[model samples]
Target: MKSVQVFAPATVANVVCGYDILGFAVDAPGDEVTMRLTSTPGIRISKITGDDGRLPLDPAKNTVSASVQHYLNALGQPSLGIDIELHKKMPIGSGLGSSSASTVAGLFAINTLLDNPLTTMDLVPFAMKGEELACGHGHADNVAPALLGGFVLIRSYEPLDIIKLPFPEDMCVAIVYPEVDVPTRDARQIIRSKVQLKDAVTQWGNVAGLVSGLFMKDYALIGRSMVDVLVEPARSILIPDFYQLRELALAQGGIGFGISGSGPSVFALTKDPETAKRITNTLQQHLQKIGIRSLSFVSSVNQQGPVVIG
Candidate 1:
């Protein structure tokens, strides 16, 4: 294939209890990248839209292009030329895994053009380069789900082990992205490196309960298990009216609500689409009442991670 276009869905990382470990893909607000092979023997970004030129065009600096470069190097073809064009459909730095989406799309496109030279799991290290370059540390909560789809658990990172979890077909999530930016680097700095033993125990219980709830298909257990005893208390203060918004969502029949990745973007899970829509509407209106204009959407869990568009 001379050219390939691929799409990678947005992901909600952390999932309240599983800090830096769990995440899931959502249907809307993803990134699309079109890659074309060239004979020039170098990587070049020909166009980028919806990011306001904030993203770098240089392959060494840009997340998507950097991932493409890594993939080429992995295939023992560092000089292979490719032209990449990015279409960012989601807001940057909104805690929605925007960078991961772009990274996954680029690697997926390149892998498709190469006719599956690498397995999906084999592309992870290359895709993670994008996250490492963006945030100064490599964490796969966002990248794993964006590449593998569905709910994922990073069981062990020492060897980069990941497992896909169960998500019921009737489940839906409401995501609200306020017109605000929370860089992951800044968000990570606010979190304390250590937690009280009590808090740590609470987090452990919640994480275990969450995993069990999903396997059991018990939505109530899942909802109750979405409590974050460590990071949320610190990171949530950065988001405006975060507590009020969660209360409103819960009141509106949302099973659970919390910050999406770090802050500024929040999500609620519901057993049905109607409840998801209601929570999204209520949250958006609440943000508006507080003079913070927001964008909200309800999406079923994305079963397919990244795929070629044409």
Candidate 2:
């Protein structure tokens, strides 16, 4: 194939207690990339849509093109001729893995056009280059699930060990992206470098409980374990009415509620789609009442990470 278009699902990272460690993909709010081989010698980003001219077009600066370039360089093809068009279906910096989705889409597109030169997992490091470019840190919480789908746990970053965790098949997520800005870089800066020993112990237990709940299919355990004492306390202040939203979600039959990634976007977990929709609708209505325009989505866990669309 000379060209291929691919779609990669948006992800919810730092899933509450598992900050920088856990994440899961959602079905909607994804990004698409169209890439074609060209006679030219280097990667070129020809178009970027839905960013309102906020994203860079230069291949070296853009996450999508930079990721593709990383993949090419890794394969010993430093001068591969490729052109990419990024279609941002989701809001940038929405705490929904927007950059990761686009990066995964781009990397997948090039790999598909090259006839599957690399496995999805193999493309992760290249995708991290995009994350490093987009945000200062090369974290994998968003990119891992965006690439592998389902829930992922970063067991170790030193050796880059990623473990895909089991989740309830009927698990539904309600996402709300309020019209607020919460840059990941700024959010990260506010977090405390040192945590109290008691808080650390509690966080560890919650993370373990969450993982166990997923494996055991215990929704209640999952709900209880979704508490985050480390990062959410610092980051929640960046989002408007974060505590009120969480209370609303819980009152509306949500299994759990927490910030999606950094802030400005939050998510609630529900057992059924109806409850998920209700939560999102109610949340959006509340945000509207507060004079905050918002976007909401109800989605099951995305099992397919990336797909060739064209």
TM-score of 2: 0.99
**What does the lDDT read for residue 307 in candidate 1?**
85
lDDT of each: 0.91, 0.93
lDDT of 2 at 235: 94
Q: Which parts of model 2 are misplaced by more than 4 Å?
A: none
> Candidate 2's C-alpha lDDT?
0.93
Worst 10 contiguous positions by lDDT, candidate 2: 65-74
In model 2, the Cα lDDT at residue 145 comes to 98
* Best candidate (score: lDDT): 2
